[model samples]
Target chain A: MTSTLKIGDVTFSKIPRVLIAKPGLDGHDRGAKYVAKALRDAGMEVIYTGIRQTPEDIAAAAVQEDVDIVGLSLLSGAHNELFPRVVQALKSRGGADIPVFGGGIIPDADFADLKRAGICAIFTPGARIDDIVREIHGILES
Target chain B: MLVRRSLDLNSLASQISGDTVLEGVEPWASRVRALSKALSLLENDPWLATRFLQHPALAKLSTNARVVGLTGLPGAGKSTLTNLIVGRLRKLGKSVAVLAVDPSSTDTGGAVLGDRIRMQDHFCDPQVYIRSMGSRGALGGVSRATRGAIRLIGLLGYDYILVETVGIGQSESEIVSIADTTTLVLMPNSGDDIQLMKAGVLQMADVYVVNKCDLSNPQRMLSELRANSEARGRGNEWTPPVLATSAAEQQGLDEFVDALQKHAEYEHDHPEGRAIKRKRVQTEIATNLLFILEREVQKMVAQVPDAEVNAVQAGQLPAMVVANRLFTEAFAMVQQGKIEKNST
Candidate 1:
């Protein structure tokens, strides 16, 4: 784990950059802030787009920051509308291959719909920090 | 199973150089996409990044964009001011790009770039492009990839480029060389006057902004800034103007915009000011060239005999002597036209 993580055949010389954004009008940033800290502690560069960011803002930041992964955290029950828009925007902005994941108050019922919309994975409330980190490694390594 | 697609460097370069295009997307529609891809390539692949930057096509695509560097201490409302400035410039129908550099963690070389949060209102605007860059262990508060990003944005036809450095003080003189006008933002009652003078921060400001004017004691801070500026004795004719603004309240932004316009005009009119700009550009070019040369030298050093390094490590030879020998070998390699071939 101390060695650089490889996404594919290419080995990165620098640390992986992860863009963690809060989409929609969700005022709660405790979750996003915690995850950002976790990723930083995991030896990844994390760019946290502050609260209430539109899908466009998140996508644009993803491309401009050149991040390896985009993590969306939402608590306002607008995940269905906002998360897909972000994935679409990232595709349009030449980041179609970048992995997208989420963690928030997303319902268990919406997991399939979110996955269909191109979300790779989702973490519910009370998820372990080590599990989230392991999920990231598994996703990137795949 | 998840599929992972690797980056295609050749295709990315072709798109950036306009030699190829994705079908169904118009040339203009693909420009931003291509630029984004090129920037990512620049960050990931050093050898390709060097080749892409030194491409002859870049020289042909010249732009007259003005690059403004905004810097201050943390929580000085730089992002707020930047958002206001972007709004003003967009109102005037000018295309703007903002490159916000955030500090990297020294231990992990990671950063949480959150500057885009304050400026998210402009996210949907096609005329405004905002980017957050990590300082990436750069001492000057700006990322090395930023120069390439600026050049790419300029080529994409941006009229103004605003570079917001990690709230840095004093020794970050690299901003002065990178920016056409370097603005130092200060907050009221911050007790920054002594630090400002000690760090030679006063000399770096082409425009001093007292942001959060609605807060306590802005006038006092403004007067202190003015006094310090006057005492420094400028090497040029233009005196940096101290302007006040409350970005949160949206007051004094008009006057701040006017001051920027006037500064631009002054630089255009004065030969001395233009000479200073030229010198800055020269310094930037020299610095980048040295960086490239250093990489080449490192490559040559890697090929040196391990016995030599072991001798130095064992204290059998002075480290400086081994370094000198490596430099001499690197110099010989450079003379043999081997350096040019090393750009893979």
Candidate 2:
């Protein structure tokens, strides 16, 4: 499977590491686990942080892990309270500019609001696994 | 079913101390490397899917993750938008999971398999979980197993689960079945604006995004959106805001986040709406599960004694009569087991 993907004359077989964390009190993990497997299949490193984390803790972990991308899975309807705190914490920790993306039961009305709060991208459930891998590849390569 | 030693949920939660693996055995930084290695192995392995489903790691996540869904049309720039949003969300100190679904080829019955190729920006990031699913001719343009996978992600304790679909179409309607919110992505120039209004996509719009604002005719598109909104008289109540974004340029992302936050507040204020939505979700799940179980049971019963089936077919007894007899027999067995347990 790794041999199937080559870019610019490079095999590009290494899997990228992504830290998938749960923040606050949201409790939904099936999507996250399936995605983790999908990414792994795509040949990327995946660090899954167990649920109920604060923005500060997540940022610190991202820093410690030296991760290039961070993802939040917010489903408890706390994107408003949690997203900003995560962004602020990341910035304060000198980890600003790291790409942050989120998706979960987020209403269509709230998608824009989340982006404005510093979320780089938003994905709803209808998203394909290939598209996600493509986005992660594009973000890391860029 | 193999029953492993069960760890009490309360005990695990209290004793685990931290979600992170016990320190020292694997340094947090190095653990990222190990995780990457594991992912690579899984990606290259043909049996990856089976092993993943059987992994013990999942048992720990009884509750602690959020699964999200994103659906749109082929050219809706879903890949681009996912990159833009996931990037920002990660920087904000959140671990993200993305399940981007792709359409299967009409000819080969296989997926085009290009999503991972297109999204390269977060390729090496240790914080993002990105995966793709082949529709494989599933109705609604998503895999049926995708729901079970979403449940697994939630149980594993991910903070956010993002499911991005191929794009807006009748098939995209499945997002409503599995996602808390479904985002409909559209381009202004598609000339389907009015169609979108009529097709119920506009009604599904919690946040309507018009991508490619940098184009010369973005405002023209916005005007059309405004006109359409006014025509519907949707502004008097909560108006779904239209945002112009250029995923390629990484523009208007902040405004997008803001809109999501505001809507979250709105949902909180209206519990009735939330309740209605949750009930629908629960019913959908129950209906699917029951349907599958019933089908399997019927199949199994068909192989039972032909004498019993023939007895009913002879018209001497009604079909319902035979069904009732079998049901009662099964019920009696269950009752007998319960009685024995109580006696013990």
Q: Which predicted model would earn the best DockQ?
A: 1
**Highest TM-score model number:** 1
Q: How far is candidate 1 from the true structure (C-alpha RMSD, Å)?
A: 5.2
Docking class of 1: acceptable
Error of 1 at B256 (Å): 2.4
DockQ for the candidates, in order: 0.27, 0.02
**Alpha-carbon RMSD, each predicted model:** 5.2, 17.3
Instruction: Give candidate 1 misplaced runs (Cα > 4 Å).
Output: A1-14, B1-5, B17-29, B55-59, B192-196, B231-236, B300-322, B325-344
Residues A16-97, model 2: lDDT tens digits:
4567777889778777766766665655445566577778677765543445578888788898789778887666544564
Tens digit of per-residue lDDT, candidate 1, span B146-221:
8878887888789999999998766776788888888988888657666656665557788999888887769778
Q: Where does candidate 1 chain B have its weakest 10-residue lDDT segment?
A: B1-10
The fraction of reference interface contacts (C-alpha pairs within 8 A across chains A and B) present in each candidate is 0.31, 0.01
Task: Estimate candidate 1's alpha-carbon lDDT, on a 0 to 1 scale.
Answer: 0.79
| Candidate 1 residue lDDT tens string, A1-142 | 2122212233234457789989988889998899898877776778887888888788877876677789999998999999999999887776787899999999999999999999999998999989998899678777
